[model samples]
Target: MPLLRLLCATLLLAAAAHACRDGGTSGEPPPAGGGGGGGGDGGGDGGGGGGAPTTPGWIERARENFEGGALPASAFAPDPVPDDGPFSDGGAYFTSRGVTPPAAFRATQPFGKDGWLTVESYSRRGDARLADHAEVVADPAGGANHVLRLRSQQHTDGTVVRPTAPLPSRYRVSLRAGFPAFGDGEAGGNNGYDAGDETAGPWWPEERAASQNGFYWLTILDALPRPHNNTWIHHHRKVVIDSDNHHPAWMETWTGDEFVWSGEHPIMMIALDGSRPGDVKTGNAFFSWSNGAWQPSGAIRAVDAYLPDRWYRVTIERDGPRYTLEVSGTFRYGGEGTYRAEIDAAQRCVWHYPVDAAEAAGAAGCVDEGAFVEGHPRWPAGGAWPDWFMFGDPHVNYYEGEVYYDDVVLEVWRD
Candidate 1:
């Protein structure tokens, strides 16, 4: 297990019991407030102008606040999206204050016009449980600097409240999140965890059954700020999984931690071994993750593989099993001929819960990595992969463990 350490260049140790306050882990320092805002014009398909509100439908322009040298008011230029409304993160973007999505922002699916993005103070999985609450506050011009805030037992048992919607290809996303009670990673010295990464893979450790932490939160995928900087498209979301699992206790970092300049498809995922379940997604190929193993994505000249979590980037572009897997932007694995055209790339696939090993084994033969292989001591699916599993430990104060997630972008063409 990794030894728990504090952030910055400071060292302050305390007992796990009294180390944190009610909202965060014990012994952690409070996060510093007051950040600076930058100056930039808004950018996006949706653009317009600002002045005194004359029409009834058009929303009123917003005023800027520059307490500690932030952006000035004139920076709030108006640019209406073509038929598209104002961009938004989740529901209420700000937690410290009662904020709402700009009038231009509206729901696209489920119930359009009806408020789709919302915020709350708490949530639960089963019965009457008090989890933390969160909200999102969008910037006036639909630019960056969107904020999020949440607190309480919401940190335990996979209790989460997030907004889901279709997204664009180019944009920048950022957030300012913190825990009031604990410093950062000080609650479950031996057992807390949280993370924000791609929504693909088993929820537990590389090998484990349930979550050691009680709760978790993160913005999976979001839009980039404007002024149309190509770099905004590639910046990935940050994932944190806090738990009271391993001995010494620590936190997990995912692929989205790095800031990219541009790319397609933005997605994020968080998990709890026992409290939450498993999830996966693939396209133009088939994939299976059970029995602690890794398998190729398709059957044609195309390819399939898990993108690397650390420094390397993995991409599998193929029409069938006869595909290629590139690591660190270089070709690491793939096939030339053999059964190339037999496998056609798939569109979509997902595994939720109540799925069994036999069902997992029956899904596909593509996942055969060490973690999902047979005879692996920690393979929770028993010799096969199940869609979902449980999360959380009642007796433990925090669910703690390590989680690694990486995001991969695929660009495929057939032969």
Candidate 2:
């Protein structure tokens, strides 16, 4: 089906979006949170003159804490869809959280009024499993305060927790997430994987390092704060499958990592009015990983360093032409502190209006190229392109780990 816009805070609907595949690999990456409150105006002293209506700083809002727990279990088996083959560096991770239909199609109200959330998952075999307790559990983090959890085992077998509704075009979202145990890539170093075997030559240098380091987008899409627009996520209704699989010729044959962003009535993020980003920097836009978490960057600044079990309160927002990223978590170095940066065009978050500034900049060292959208670019879907936020690994090849999520809030600036 399409990217449904069903925002019901109180009602419940059990459904799923099917991106059917017939096995084999190859493709590109695919990509909500919660609730509301009035701001700026506080309850002043009861004066003789009535105070003006307390205006909310945000024009629209949606949030999810998973406190009410999950809705009743609902199982879905998507009917087989046509095969369309692989997307750019595609690996078979297709997911959408809270995959409910539109208000007219299902019972829905404004976003976040619904205290419950829904989850849907798919494998490459055109088979789908929806609403399994093991996949999504509320309050698994050991608090009556509650939290949302998503876990994936297979390389390409992942799930998503869709929200009751969508966030506004221009919005600020905040959430807490944790990767309990990120595998250490250095086999012979410390942590005791091979113990004393200093010569661990199982994988290629790049593959070994990449495998040890969990990815922000290589697996999980839209888990943290990033810019979004009409070009949210584009999935094919009919997935293409190549009978004779072979490794692509690499950089010389590099056409684009976003080949899946094109072709036919693809599902997700495509506006009803027909708008797609000419550039491939919106969803799965690149960032640098350092000092544990994947720090926001203009160009690619990645070293396959390892990540241990840790938690952080992550906030990514777009205010006008500037993007702000703030992360705070307990670290081995200085315990807990906040690291924030407000990025603009000068930082090379993007090169030129066209993405040709230096396509092959990786030859030297990775340069800041792609960037997140500066503001909430409108999507005709009645909300953001996806109109949903995902909370688990959505890619098949790289990371297969658990992500703990809580207290998600999405907001639209009043301006």
Candidate 3:
């Protein structure tokens, strides 16, 4: 089975989200020259500079993992939450097609009730329940009738909620989020076992390969593969916008201490596969992970800023291949910033036949078989678009913390 399916199955059976291991931490700050900032054409070949320094070593390691057979079994853990109840009160709106813009297709959730949200634990170090970490209670701050309360206890936990229907091509998603003022000090060590405090958290052991310590994440799952021979193409396609409370560089291995505090930074990332301008897969070819491999197409860092006990509005809009992410509010660090990224599908590349076919033909034929070709007609079918939106720490591990979310709105465009 594919890695993602296996993960979902495991979580379904186990009744908790605990796939993947915790990442190790190093006391050293992310190497110099790693800061990310500034904005330009989101599709430019130039790597976004001025934020966190690039961690080439970590990237290389992730590449190796992608190429080296399947992701580690250790990486395929279970999500603690169950898929129960409706994702939204507005049914059938998500699947309605061709309804043009200015026309609103919204799924608003206030979190005042309990049936709409599903919470799961994503850590392996300790025993924690989704209910223990998440709750739908009256807002003490008196902003809304009910708010989604998420707490990161000894492990990194998350919650998943889908829309009433699939999202349209052009739409705006806005939500109010705040990190409550609470401190838990430090807890774990550097060797993948230590759960750091509010400042030191964990990252996905299988991807990115680092921790953000004390931060919040809102991930949107855009595309998913259909049930067919070529399903891997849609797996793991999503956008991740995270607030990095503790700036840590990606590590090549799990060999560092947990308490190293770097600083604070906010990041936006898009994960996809596509060829570069000068790559062999030019023309009609586009990138596809048919063989179960993925690469980060873009990682843009926003201004390094965030404040506790303050509410901020985060909006993510997708139009065609372009995505615009913005954050605003008193606690917002990047200001009323607009960051864009365009995915050039024409530059995608795909291998002909399978790796085994090339291997059977010897070195010369192997090279020919491995060559990039035009993407299939069904390359980016409707199944490859986002259908759900989620919040909280999906795949990161942390010691302890609390986050609050309210007033989520999803708006669809006509033109």
lDDT of 2: 0.33
Ranking by TM-score: 2, 3, 1
Candidate 1 lDDT by residue in tens digits, 1-415? 1344444223443444344545455455545432222222211122223443333222111111111221111111122322211111111112113433122211111111122222212112233222122223332224554433233332322212222232111111211122212122223332222342211111111332122222222222122211111111112111112222222232222222323221111111221121111222111122322112223333111121122121222222222212222223211122121111111211122211113444344334333233211332222333332111111111111222222111111111211
**The CA-based lDDT of model 3 is what?**
0.36
Instruction: Judge candidate 2 at residue 7 and give its lDDT.
Output: 48
Writing each residue's lDDT as its tens digit, candidate 2 over 150-201 gives 5544333445454444433345666776653323333233221222222211
Give me candidate 2's TM-score against the actual structure: 0.48
Question: Where does candidate 3 stray beyond 4 Å?
Answer: 1-130, 138-145, 180-211, 214-217, 223-237, 247-262, 265-273, 276-300, 331-383, 396-400
What's the CA error at residue 390 for candidate 2, in Å? Answer: 3.7
Task: Report the lDDT tens digits of candidate 3 across residue range 151-239.
Answer: 65543333334443455555566677776532322223331223332222111133221234433345455432111001121222344
Error of 2 at 236 (Å): 14
CA lDDT, every prediction?
0.22, 0.33, 0.36
Q: After superposition, how far is residue 264 of candidate 2 from its true place, in Å?
A: 40
TM-score: the better of candidates 1 and 2: 2
List where candidate 2 sits over 4 angstroms from the true fold.
Answer: 1-60, 79-118, 124-141, 162-166, 188-310, 345-389
